[model samples]
Target: MSYSNAQELLSAIQPASGGTEIFDPATGELVGRVAQNSVADLDAAVSAARTAQPAWDALGHEERNRLLNLAADRIEANAEALAELLSREQGKPLNGPNARFEIGGCAAWLRAATAYEVEPEVVVDDGETYAAKHYRALGVVGAIGPWNWPMMISIWQLAPSLRMGNTVVMKPSEYTPLSVLALGHVLNEVLPADVLQVVAGGREVGEKLSGHPEINKIMFTGSTPTGKAIIRSSADTVKRLTLELGGNDAGIVMEDADPKAIAEDLFWGAFINTGQTCAALKRLYVPESIYTQVCQALTEVAAKMPMGVGLDENNVLGPLQNKAQYNIVADLVQGAVDSGATVLLGANPDSEAAGYFYPTTLVADIDPQNDLVTKEQFGPALPIVKVKNVEEAITHANSLETGLGASVWGSDREQALAVAARIQAGTVWINSHGTIDPRIPFGGAKQSGYGLEFGLDGLKALAQPQLIKG
Candidate 1:
């Protein structure tokens, strides 16, 4: 079987089509079908997770770390297969620059989680009482993931939670659930039965997982609206929650920065992964001094890139993963054009042939208050807003409802640092965007959602602290 769809994968377990369809956007071919998960299935996965969690949690740090490392090794060994599944299902360029890196990064995160050297610092003062703090796991985490990067996102949800000793019941986006199923197969080989189960279905499946009495924690990465709903449902249990929601990140190019360097940062931040990244640059604010030059340079760069399969090994761009997103990108771009925004570079869907792919688009004259600037495009559409000064750029970037990540471009390290301090996002890059490493803590400051993932801190988010005093 070539990993067609969720239903096909589930066929080995049960009989039913489940009413979900999976297609390859590049070819519009039905890759797989999924069985709609029912309430019974939810109960089963949760029960299995709950039953196995205690023993898994009982293992020492070394034992747990070993298991996690094993998973990372497997992922590294199968990077190509994983990347192909990811690109085929998500419609990203095959073997794209970032896809495989993301997989490798997942492996790195696992090792980092294992090697986190955090010892409880004991305080010995004049009148100090002895106390030692320790962190422990919250069993049975319910993870609701998005479709953009299913494998990496699933690893994001699993690596730390499992490292911390919590079991997982993941409900991936319906459109791209097959990758999760594929992931589950890899996990089952190393993990005990029921430690990590991919529960298929839709909103109802997620609802059961979030509201299930057995679930101890809920970690979700998806749209802001969906995130809010998950929070509301988890309130009854107050299930330990971690959310990495949508982002409308901005790139600020200061007047002092090199236009060539700034344009390169803008291009990758706004166009990589077909610009479907949650934290990829969606809004760009350029210094007025070099606006035209920057725009021309960005246009030239965008034009040279090709779109194709994420597994094709040669294609650099790919079609949008779904129809709804294609429409969203189209509407936002067309709206910008209708409002007198200049098409620095791009093809209007109205003028294009077919498929869900959009050209690397550059839209200028976009008001800071416009919908295109304020919303998460989640596509390869760049809306540049030229600002008079860094102060205005900072002001506008902080206005959005999401704040996952942002980039600041300039040569003055101190000045860029000072400007970066003012930006409301949690992760700010001085001269780069979408450059994440396992050694750092990653999360959003505002509505981009709470709870951190990656690094020693990432594992800590899944742990509970207990003070042991003598």
Candidate 2:
């Protein structure tokens, strides 16, 4: 059945006895309901994946590559329709800087997965005794994706697992399940039955997946607290895990950087996905000399950008994905304001508005200890802090326990590169922030979580390495 929006998609599924309500953050309208899948359902999905995995692995890399490529083609064909539903449910604008961009990202990742080839590595060749290392598929992979960038992130998890010759049971976040469910439908058209499954529900379902004994590996993308819980729960079964968790990423602006030249890039780096992205620039550290100029430049650029519902073509930014997140952003910004931080733009949100809309906000002249600077707001609010020098900026940037990604901005390329190397993050950019590519590995450091995704490293993570000696 053709479904234009999330409500229609859910209606076609035949509502179960108990399900979680899904609402559009842009309009605060009930868009759909996702079945509250129980542990039994999780068991069934995992069991099915286990049964399917052996034969899938037997297909070998060549055949698997062919099928994955076909799936990518199908995804590209249906990209437009999927992008609209994603915009409606996920609250990213359909055009310009949003949903369509994510849809394209999904397709790009899938295509990249098809191109990656894994082969046996020769470890030693002493003539008398030769040794090699081969990668083999793990049984069943359980993937739990987050609300922000659901489609792309899900593809990141699923494509790699499938290409590595493993079966998957995935659960998209309760807040944005429709687009992923739709994606599952498209892939299943080309994939074998029970090879890929998408189960929708809330926290209980996720807990079940993480702890399930049958799941050989678990891949999750969400908050740091949740990642810790998963790590603890998976202890019994000891399932291999790959987590892309929370990041209070910091960006440093060197005194040599031109405020006007970098303002637009810097603004979007923080506010893209309404600042809901885990790797987005959350805390910006500017040199004391250029702090005011940097803030003014960013404020001017942000003021001109349109913010509204996702379906609007002209709107570049949309509402927070849910009310709880909206409140978090609002509360944190207020706390910063109360602490005497200067509000450069968008201090107020329309309380009477129909949606969970928080305007693109920028807070400046904030102390490092301020809650806004210390916490991960994960909404359209940024805290800009002044630093005495590059040494202070690096210190403040590395102060957070979570370090998924970071960035360094400066006109002096060599100096910026030197500073970028010192930042303690999984990924560090010299002139940009959170510029993820399909071919490069991405993950977290320290409390952010463990394991990597993307590139050969990601593929290897999905499989176990077997050493051969002859």
Candidate 3:
């Protein structure tokens, strides 16, 4: 069935027995429903995926690549309708780093995954003997995608696994399952039955899926706490896991950096997807010498950017995706204020507002010990802390338990690169932050979770290495 909107997508889904209602975060209105899939449904999906795997694997890499490209083509064809539904459910603005951008991202990643090839590596070629290392598909990949950037992140996990010939049973976040289900619908047209299935549900379904003995591998993108739980759950079955978890990523601005030149980049880096992005610049450390100037420059830029419902093309920033997240951002910012941090721009949003709309906020002169500085406020608020020097900035940036991404901004590229090396993160940027390429590998350091996504390493992560000897 073709799904042009949230309701249409909802109607197309035949969720197991029970399900939960979904709402539009931008309007606080009931938009659709998702199946609250039970453990039985989870088991059934795993069984089907396991049953489907060998046939998919037998298709070989070239055929797999062909089908994945077809799926990508279908995604591009349905991009407009998909983007509208994504905006409605995800609460990201229609323009300016919103639904269209995410849908485009999905197509790009799928196409990129098609181009990536994991050919057998010849280890020996002596006249007497020959040996090679070949990649083989793992069975029944269970992918759990998060609500923020739901479609793209799901594609991040789904594309590589399918391209490597693994059948997948995916569980998208209940908050944003429609877009993923709609995506599944589009792909189902091009793929074999049971090759790519989306099961919508809450935590119970996810936990069951992770721990299922039938599932050979689990790929999850969500909170670190939840990642830890999944790791624990998979221990009994010893499932291969790839986790892309929570990140309170930091961005450091050097004394030599031009505040005006970097202001726009810094603002978007921190506030993209309404700052719900896992790899977004959560905390910014600027040199004390220019910290005030940086804050002023960012504030000026933010003031011109519109914030409202996602459907409005004029809005660059939209509401927080849910009430729970909105509360977390509100409380953290308030706690910081209570401890004496100055609000450089924006404040606690009106609680009674029609939607969970938190303003693009910048908190200044924040104490290093404050929760706002220490915790991940995954919303449209950023805390700016002043550092004595690059060394101190690196120290503070690396101090966090979570290190998914970090950035060093300065006029001198060499100096910035030097500092970027010191920050403990999987991806470090010289002048930009949180910008990712499909060809580059991305994961986390420390508690940010493990296993790489994207690139050749990512493709190999989905496969087993088989060494052949003569």
Candidate 4:
């Protein structure tokens, strides 16, 4: 069921009637059209999923795992086509850890869900009484995904739900629906009808899907504001939620760390996917002793990575996904410049350019309280703040209520580990940032949102616990 080209894949997901038109952010060229499904469409999808859950549950783990593995195989077979569509729609380079990487991650996560063990657990075994804990599927799940990594996040929401015997109805971001729709088509090649549905539309459809009474749980990944809105909408239904919201992740450079050695890792950490990642490093704190060296090294690395249209084989970074995002990035960087922050590499953008292309930018000596430092300006810009000591670094890092991820860089593992322990983020990386693995559990802390994703814990999030005593 794999397509030979992206156009063939696009044809598979196009709406019967004319729908919303999608354009490439890099070239402003039309990519394709996706069905702007309605509340009625979402309702019908939910109803179908509700009807299919029981029979899917009846097949049990063995049968379901088999199908999931088969779906992974199909994903691999169609990886090239899927990657092309993702690159065009999402504005990420095909060659870098962008489009292809995301597609690979989707398949890898599905296989991980199948391999994980979530069998019944024996709680107590006394001769007189025995108790066991079992997990049962929570009916239908509503998954709302973000635009940055649409396909991968959709799989993140759906894989565990299906593994736990729950059916899912997904709502993709209007900005990147074709990628999700294409992914859904590939997956459905192996999945049962109604077990998984992707309804692509606007704000109205998303609001209704969150509040729908039939859906037992909701999993979402996006901005903190939208996450809060969903929280309010789902209140009456009391729907279970797993939210991976906005992150202003920080990276700290210790005095003992070699600026040149860690610089490349640092650059990719902040600028990966052209700095569009939710958990990508946004704020960087460098000790005053090594601050100059660190900034220089990072600038050198950023200079080498070319930015252009996604299809180019040489470009490692692409344009902002859309004009609105481009404007946000532009405004924030301009504010920092106006506040007298020194531009280490790039702050100049061609406003008259044909595409939403902003150069990979690095701002140095910025105030700890600057809007660029405090806000989640998710783009290809990194603001470097010079700190007197690690204590000051930690204070500024933890100052923001949004703590999804953070990183501590140093030569000594023990010192890095000790510093990592104090960071308020959900997952703190030592010497690296935003390198997620399917085996490890990932989530957020404080206002960044809650509930874990990945590994065994993620499976439990989609199911209900039942205790039996004999």
- Each prediction's TM-score versus the true structure: 0.94, 0.97, 0.97, 0.99
Give the best candidate by lDDT. Answer: 4
Worst 10 residues of 4 by lDDT: 346-355
Off by over 4 Å in 1: 1-19, 118-128, 350-354
Those runs of model 3 whose alpha carbons end farther than 4 Å from true positions after fitting are: 1-7, 14-19, 126-129
RMSD to the native, candidate 1?
2.7
Ranking by lDDT: 4, 3, 2, 1
* Tens-digit per-residue lDDT, 1-470, candidate 2: 34455445455553665567777889877766667677788889889889988999999988998898888887777777788778888998987668999988888898788777799999999888899999999889999999999999999999999999899999989888877888898788899999999998778989999999899999999999999999999999999999998999999999999999999989888989888999999999999999889999999999999999998899999999888998899999999999999999997988899888998999988889999989999999999999899999999999889999999999999999999899999999888888899999999997888899998898999999999999
Query: CA shift at 88, candidate 2, in angstroms?
Result: 1.3
Query: Mind giving the per-residue lDDT tens digits that candidate 1 earns over 119-143?
Result: 6656433456677778888889998
- Per-residue lDDT of model 4, residues 181-300, tens digit only: 999999999999999999988899999999999999999999999999999999999999999999999999999999999999999999999999999999999999999999999999
lDDT of each: 0.80, 0.89, 0.90, 0.95
TM for candidate 1 is 0.94
Lowest lDDT 10-residue stretch of candidate 2 = 1-10
Q: What's the CA RMSD of model 3 in angstroms?
A: 1.6
Give the clash total for candidate 3. 1
Each candidate: RMSD: 2.7, 1.6, 1.6, 0.8
State each candidate's clash count. 15, 0, 1, 0
